[model samples]
Target: MVQTVISVAGASADCPEWVLIDLQGSLETRHPVPLSGRFVGDLHFTQKDVPILIIGHHILYGKTVHLEKPFAVLVKKERSADTSMETDQNVSGTSYHVKALIRRKLLFKTRPKPIISNVPKKL
Candidate 1:
């Protein structure tokens, strides 16, 4: 019997996929989604509203959990991850900064999606 489910990764292109749920109230994944009790407990207790793969007995739904970061924040975070240099930039009259946040309870980390902003910058 499974009491909880936690998904570390396996989302593709922001698309929804189907999964299988067992009669034991446990979610099943084809690729063994870290079902260890310790891991799931840590994740559930720590990460608020973490994306989980639900394999129901008759229904499967694909869902994703976001860190509540704005689109601009995600872009800036990725740009900063690429380098060790200062991420503060003053383009045109706006200011941009990048920051990385790690959950203190879960060992797994989530990075923002890589986005290429088409906004023209002042040369």
Candidate 2:
């Protein structure tokens, strides 16, 4: 499956080209990644493999948000070298298998959850 990584995009007039991102642990949301900086210019974002262009006062600063494929190596480390060779069991011999194989991808924009208001309204 694919993974997410938040990277810096553009710079401000008074500040150098830099951005700070904090992936809040255990609180992952697919919403437009929250941004906090000196000057947050007007933004146009979507949930797709598209570049995130930061426009400041009509100037388009182009930068693409990237995604990574999750991976794992069957190789044993140097200190634990030959460990893999020692095990003659194939993947099927063990309980190892592909968890998921994503062929078709679909992304639907979810609506905000409704909430009940405590304040009474006019009849």
Candidate 3:
């Protein structure tokens, strides 16, 4: 199994701040990741791994506006063939086995906001 990171940046002038992301992987995995800055949401990879982050914008007054901060999602790959066996004895004398593995972290940053004009005009 292989891990991949997807980084999205905000667009330039007159561009849309909202974006829809469709992620496809080797395991036939399909995930929809919406980009906004309003309310936060969670990105679920497969059935077990889910990354939590804030949404970028909100649809209010029939319009979509950007939020103050940006958001991101992280995904890691896990293999079924890679397994480990462990035995644990409890008070009931029952044996419990489990598998342990490590996953890497992915980081995504938001685009910088455009500067506005604040100069005064002289007549």
Candidate 4:
């Protein structure tokens, strides 16, 4: 298996959507990676509670992991894979910035139904 590294550019709320990722200066090839779930790791204070994807052998979150910088990460494809290359180094000393993107609002309308009732009234 070939090893590849990609920087986490951003994430989309819609599942099964193609997220944009920058491959850190390497432009020889491109591939579509289907992301099913978020990445798992002991994230730093900046990375906590953020959405991420598991690419190649690293758990990438935010834009904290630079495209041209080298960082240590856990190397495993499946949950049963041997996690021996795992390390405790994160995008060292990098601060995280959270930005919220606005999405189109969904408006739903329902038709009013006629009311029919039968009741006895006392005078």
Task: Give a tens-digit lDDT track for model 2, residues 1-123.
Answer: 222222222332222322222121222235667654434433444565432333232323233422244222122222234564675444222232222222222222232223444658732
RMSD of 3: 20.4
Top-lDDT structure, candidate number: 4
For model 3, residues 101-122, the per-residue Cα lDDT tens digits are 1123322233323334365763
What lDDT tens digits, residue by residue, belong to model 4 across residues 32-77?
Answer: 6544463423333343534343333344444422223222232223
Span of ten consecutive residues with least summed lDDT in model 4: 103-112
Estimate TM-scores for all models.
Answer: 0.14, 0.17, 0.18, 0.17
Candidate 1, residues 1-123: lDDT per residue as tens digits?
A: 212222223443342333221122343566866767632211122165443332222222223333344222111223334442553343222223422222222112232233345668842
Clashes of 4: 0
Order the candidate numbers by lDDT, best to worst. Answer: 4, 2, 1, 3
Q: Which numbered prediction scores highest in TM-score against the true structure?
A: 3
Better of 1 and 4 by lDDT: 4
Off by over 4 Å in 2: 1-37, 46-54, 61-123
Candidate 3's clash total is 11
Q: lDDT values of the candidates?
A: 0.31, 0.32, 0.29, 0.32
Off by over 4 Å in 4: 1-49, 63-123
